[model samples]
Target: MKEYNTVFPNLIDDRYFFQDISIDKLPIMDKYNGMINVSAYTDAAEYINAQDVTFYGAWLLNMLEERLIALENYLVYDVEKPELVSYTNTEPTGVPVGYCWT
Candidate 1:
């Protein structure tokens, strides 16, 4: 019997720094007579304010930007080298491997 050890790094740990907001606490709109009232919008504003949605949203955006920058910096690939080489067909009846119709 053999045992393997594996470790995975957390990428979005900062996302969990903020407490989770409940969906039930969010505002619910009323659609009476096929129209929504201004009170629904006001309730939504209140909900947003109470949950600090804007602040967390901005934080998430910043985190995403940082992660993207890190990924771009970490990637090191040779642009001069061909990634895929086309295989020539030697058989008379079959299509060649890595052949493109266009």
Candidate 2:
């Protein structure tokens, strides 16, 4: 018979207590120029007071702005009234082009 190790998601280790570890082991934070003392009680208050950060120069914002302009153009100018668009031999249903409402 072969032996195998079993893994479970919510298992807790018995050897190490969380309070036994010091905060100095944490990597230096560029934002604060120091390692964070990750006490749940203290950090929760600090996080509440911290200002929101946004990536204003992100590419997705520019792409979304462009999409908004294209959508505005599509809704305002590119749309043809159903009666104006000449689909060969098909009668206009009077709804806007591409909206197939009965």
Best by TM-score: 1
- Candidate 1 structure quality by residue, lDDT tens digits, 52-75: 333344445655666666555545
**Once superposed on the true structure, which residue ranges of model 1 sit more than 4 Å away at CA?**
1-20, 23-55, 77-102
Q: How far does residue 48 in candidate 2 sit from its true spot (Å)?
A: 30
Per-candidate TM-scores read 0.27, 0.25
Error of 1 at 63 (Å): 0.2
Candidate 2 residue 83 C-alpha distance from true site, Å: 7.9
Tens digits of per-residue lDDT for model 2 on 78-98?
667454445456655556655
Error of 1 at 102 (Å): 21
lDDT for 101 in candidate 2 is 32
Model 2 regions lying over 4 Å from their true place: 1-57, 82-102
